[model samples]
Target chain A: MNLTILIVMAVLTGVLGSPYVTDTDVTPGSDSAGMSAHPNSVPEAADGTEVFHEEGVVEEEGVEEDVMATGELNPSHYPAQRAANVVKHYLNTRYGSPYRWVGLHKVHSANAEEVAESGRKYHLEISVQEMTGNTTEKCSAEVLFPALENQRSPQVQASCEALLTANTTAQEEALYQQYRRNHTLLSGHNLPDSYGHIDPDMKPLWHLGGVASSFVMLKESTENTLYNMAQVANVTQLETENDQLRFNYHVLLHDMVSQEIIHWKLLVTWSPAEGVKVLQMEELPKCEHCEVPPKPN
Target chain B: MKALLILIVLMNLDKNKCFAFLSFSDQVLSITAKTQEQVELLKNVSTQYETVLWQPVSPEYIKEEEPVHLSPSAFAQSFASRFCFRVLLDNTNEMIELQTRNDSTDPRSSSSYYERYHSLEDIYYWINRTTQEHPEMVKVVLIGSSYEKRPLYALKISVGEKQDKKAIWIDCGIHAREWISPAFCMWFSLSYYNQNQDITHILNHMDVYVLPVMNPDGYKYTWTTNRMWRKNRSYSTDSSCVGVDLNRNFDANWCTEGASDKPCSEIYCGAFPESEPESEAVANFLRSHKDSVQLYLTIHSYSQMLLFPYSCTLDEAENHNELLVMAQEAAQKIRRYYRNTYKYGAGGKTIYLAPGGSDDWAYNLGIKYSFTFELQDRGRYGFLLPPSHISKACNEALIAVKTIALRVIEKTQAPQ
Candidate 1:
């Protein structure tokens, strides 16, 4: 066989092995390519200084070395930890939940297998890696979960009603937490650009943008416990002179009680003079004419 | 007063004559023919608003054959006779008696008779009775309350069970007008109690929860004013429109596709995911029990279909194989039992992409098995599934559910 064909065949052969095989378990000694033992996995030495391979695939001699190794945090670390905690708390609070795979199909059948595979992928993505990375960094805080803290307040209900009617909020943004957690289990689906930035690993980290939507405040003001959804659009991320990344995103906000809908598209870029700034809001022109309707006489 | 008098006269007139004759009441004599014609121009309106009814014109007027229409006792007898085993109608007879008509234009409303389901009370009564009789396997819980403060209840059924067990949830009536959706849940519950021993074993090992009438206010309104409302009656102060499509109100790819922001639209997704009280209650409940909720089935109507999750987008899910196999098996069982053809595939792939749906939301939350069932004939009957087909449809659905349940028990048991 030709070299190209031979290489392709070899790669396929390597991939087709048992799925349960782990990276470290499969690749040993000189064969290790991209495997990196997590910091927690490494044993602590007598001194604070620790020796490690720059390439994550290998573990070399450990000696007390003085080098600032400031690695960027795993994008999924914060959200995943929070999610795990939240889920655990959820289970504890509710006692227990009923489980179902695919309610309509029988097991060991074609559809059942597909469902099983989807579940497997779900674990790999959410439980293991961040599937949806930061799609947009224009927002200051990502909206993690949306909940009405004052569940019985009339004003909150009225505001929700207003938002619902105006069509300002999209349902997707409103239920970001539920959808984000569930998206991993869904068949292969991709996240929108506004939520997070795509890392080298292709996983979307949670941009502060998603966390902005679910803010709850004891009192309504410029700032409080719950931040307003519109504030995220005003946020801008910094950039260096050589490599400047621009962010364009779609933001959806909905108030259930008032039936108000608010949708805005934002573009933000970095500039040496201004540091970071918003370029445009796509929905401004469209919404200019959509003034709030007059209340009944 | 004058309009009322004329309406009464029209009601008294022979049905055929009323259609043929356009009466110019002397009181309305001042108006010109153009104006008078405009007054009588309107023919039929949806189940919500009031409208004038026209007499049948030959073939058009001929009423189609009604499906199975059994009185409460007769329904019981029919179930016993048809199954040739035990019929569990007494357990859910109150629900059968609480009937609502699918025909909104009919002057004779189903609510006037003993058939239409009037309120959440009626639905709960039936669920409670069904579970009570089958205490060995069934248990009930009041999950939460609706926007209008109606209690939302879910029935858990298993043959050999205790409360602490893995389970599947089947929620119906997201769209209020689809009466058959809730009926299917009732039927499934009853069947688990009365039918096959295998199902009993599966239930004993695994719990099955059913939510009938997710949108109670809209459902109650369907019985009272309108018979075609497809949303929850959550009051929106900004606009006169007062409902949100609960089915389109879930958090799965929520507003991405096949949904509307306008509250008046048929497929209006609420302002946000879990924005409505009904959806929030369900979501909170599910979130709390995320690990145990292995399978989720949201029942809807008209189309005979079995759909999987990720309805918000046209992407394959992680558990596509297992879901596909299970779906096929369920479809096959349904066919064998009732000879009904059910189309099965991924939600986004099989049908148009729909966001903010329960099945998709449940799937996203790591419950690998999520499905939406559009029960009965495609659209000939629409939400108007005849009473005649209830038993057969229920039986078929039960078989399909059992197949899934048994598989779930096996899968949950097999290793991790």
Candidate 2:
């Protein structure tokens, strides 16, 4: 932790000069001469949130030049957008893998504030997309841009565990054991068998496909793309390497915006304790009769 | 008409005490904090004009360009400058008025009847009146009473004499502030006879149990005290904070991530699973009917998603594929018909990993086909889905309900 910390408080509209805004503010404070406060105020802990009063570095009163905030920010605007952009980098740094590309799908909310000594800090609640897995999470994070003198990767504080998991090795192990016991190298032509239905036994592979593809998606995605795992075109389980089970998968990526079904082949490895790791990705030549969604998002 | 007048007077008498004296934020605005200069400018405005943030819950959460909705004091409007403020609500007081509005209308006008958001008193009246009108199909089953002693009414919808048949259990308004959820339940019941083929077909093979307003105490609190109130109105004797998140009071991985153990936390799991009477009532009902109930569905709002079991863990449900397809079909049906997109997947994988969810609990209880549907307006309107959008939202939900229920029937009742 740095000795001098920065605090960016968004939505402190009436308490700009004040060091803090508490529940007491909801009542028309005596300081407010004419304005009336909200009478039907939310009781403490009633609104699915804990008051953002953290036990962090609290500075002295009267740092007049220290704070900056506007309650909400435009998603398209630079400050908020850049904050969202940093989260993409943060996820890649934390959960990045081969064959997976991650990016910000949408910004639910973004706001920025500049504090003294350090730099500007942004509090953002955003949805992150793991492109290959076709999975998304609405994650709330804090990103701080340091002062010019203390330049570094934008300091990020986000708990995006949905895209990354380390504790589920038990489930992975059990599945791996079951797969190994089958003796023959598992291989399948299509995940859903073309009936838009995955066989009971084949469901786990489909899920792992999504998980492995997330790495590629995370690597290649951006603010503009909305990707979906259209199918596991074909997958063949390779011989076990040490402890991990390796598989070669060809999957279809449907770009919802362009309504194009793109094909790619992935070299993925999985083990119960360790997790799905994409070894490589290769984009195959486009097929002429690739099906298109009637209405793509 | 005379009875309706008395109900109105009673609702007013109830509201005029403590609640009527409440003051509300006149206008709510979604504003942008684009730069340091803009943040300073907003700080100056708040210090000068006194606007309060409606979203983000507190000022500490504000960041550059993080979408924060501000309930700027009417006083701030004249002097507010520099920030590009997008108006979200002119006056939340007006919205609150409609939510608690009690008006007499001809039941024949289905539009007027189903469109308005009803008060606790209004919903009870509707349940009684509807049961009387449709004596053959609808029967009110009192599952249990809330902490405040309000009877939890579950409407059992069947076509004829109830015989041993498969059942589907759906409980709504579990979180209280989710008024749209209870509204969907009412809409679902009414449409059972709306010349709706899907509802009729499901009722042929399965009896539907619809519990509207599961958390009556919390639901009533939102009307009388806090509009954004979630959780039930129950209190732990040791803690000052009132209420347990009923959704998180189930037995499946109780008090895990996305849930809190502290009594004051919003998603606080009760002292133990099934601790809250609301969750206990629903759990007991499902347990007793575990053999016959083929499916379970719970309703919530704001984010449009069809979620199935295993919200407690990252691991896939034993029937993950089956549940996912059912939810997918439901979402696709809504999209194809109403043109609204809905994300569908495992509750843990699709959204956040919220433990102690009813859907997961029900699935663990052997009800393989379980779901939680979050309905309407991704984040734009959120829980305060307006009355104008009520019909469309309800119809979209109805499509999903029918699609899933029909699918369950096919899978369970197919010629063996």
Candidate 3:
């Protein structure tokens, strides 16, 4: 009876051990003993957070460790360094092609001391150089990356989505300023002419149309004497809603022939699809009869 | 393990492929970036999104609202509004197709010098044929080979005895996509060959050297691969980007203000002055014949402006008054004949500061009569000016060239 039991136990052990050996043989690089056969099949926690490994590599056993270590110290302690790394990697991945000349000149942490205790955000200033023939031209960019506390790694994998440069702010300001200025100038605002201030190509339409009907009629009656002077003023209000920049401006228009000044309120909207345009230009009723003031000079 | 291996292979494949999907059907936009901020925005967008800048002006000179051509994608369309640029060309591809169709038609269609934009092969054939047909008037000279080993041909049009005659060097298509420029060169050559009363007078006094296509490799590339390639096909050592802007690759103030250092940029000044074979060859020829080459006329397109040095700086050239007067005369002649307006002024002030231009370099080399003719409708069509408009553009350019040549002859005669 003891011999029969020993043989039976050996057979059962062999049957189970044979399958494990075959699985390991079939999948060479996978850590089958640690977890699942599929290396990329990551497991999630109860709260749907990705559990990461200590080394930041997504290993199979990392799922259980991440879930258990949720209450422990956070892995991404240095947010600034992480953000800088993210941007650097992104630049290399995007521009480091055989056909492109963009090279990373320098990558340094910007506003490191400004990092919040929560370690949720970081900023980095990066300078990139493009090698054209024998010359190297340099341009700098500012990157702002936001970190999610529950992310698998300290570096946001999608920080490229938040890549910001000097252009971002400049682009936004230009749209707002142009809309406001166009609104002011078109609504009969005679703004001062300084170099680079007014559009050189701006031409006033002589045809009677829309809100300019009255102005056109008046201009035709005093065609020779009445010279219409239009100028754009500072944008009083600017907002971006639904991917469009809306602007409000105080416009001034002077009629030299009539010796009258017109104060107008204008609204302008700009978008990539529609381009910079005046949504509405209304001649404010209050300033219709305002007399032109003489210059101090 | 298999999945990991497959992913690595896919990544490698992605690296080899062009990130920007530039196709023949893609739309090109001409937008004005007016402010310093707008210029920066455009430059940033160009680098990040890989948009090909068609304008010859570098990113630094984009201040005060310079018109730029951008081949837009979904990515570029997103930033158009934020930059506050007005759209100049809504569908550049449409016009390109129209121009291409016009160019592909047989050269035998019309007999007035040139009817349409011709290919490099056709232009060469025409050059050879012109030399053969009018052996007494025209002779083809091979100056140098391009980066791709394409021969650079210059037609010597001398009707009178070659002894002691001053020469005028006229080169066009420095920027490859300026099809009108090369067209103008061919037209000027043929028109001068016909020996009209004024042309005969000018030719008798001076020998005209016409190089229709300056950058042959870039011109061929524009015809075959990309229609908007602007630089010579010289590889950059420090960067992977190809080609050098031959106009900006001259030794004078090279790679300075208004010239780019980015290899992929349109206005990329080469690694060194005369780094490109095309520019180097032209430079060598000009230097060798600097004494006899009395006038240097480099033709460019789109902007209706006649410019003279000094383009590298705001400082006026020694012969500023003479140059200004001659350019004004040329512009006035063009206006009188063609009913078109051509702005005539110093290069740096009239158009933004563009260093290393051939005209500027030649002027610095003592060729006081160097003038750059920016031909045709300011921005109505940009580089994609239709073949139908070629006749009108070439006609206007001919008047200007004739005017400048006549002035050079008169000046030389006055001194004699």
> What i-RMS does each candidate reach, in Å?
34.1, 23.0, 35.1
lDDT of 2 by residue, A1-297 (tens): 110110111111121101112222322233222112221122122222111111111111111111123456644333454567667666654554432345556666777777688777788988776543445677889877776666454677897656554334455567778887778899875554321234557767766675666555545544233445556768899988888889999876654223234678899887655656778989887532343222110
**Candidate 3 DockQ, CA atoms:** 0.01
lDDT of each: 0.45, 0.63, 0.53
Ordered list by lDDT, greatest first:
2, 3, 1
User: All models, DockQ values?
Assistant: 0.01, 0.01, 0.01
Every candidate's CA RMSD: 28.7, 26.4, 33.7
The number of clashing residue pairs in model 3 is 12
lDDT of 1 by residue, A142-191 (tens): 11232244232111110111111222124223333332344332211112
lDDT of 3: 0.53
Winning candidate number (TM-score): 2
TM-score, every prediction: 0.44, 0.48, 0.46
**Candidate 3 share of real interface contacts:** 0.00
Q: Per-prediction TM-score, chain A only?
A: 0.22, 0.51, 0.24
Which candidate do you rate higher for TM-score, 2 or 3?
2
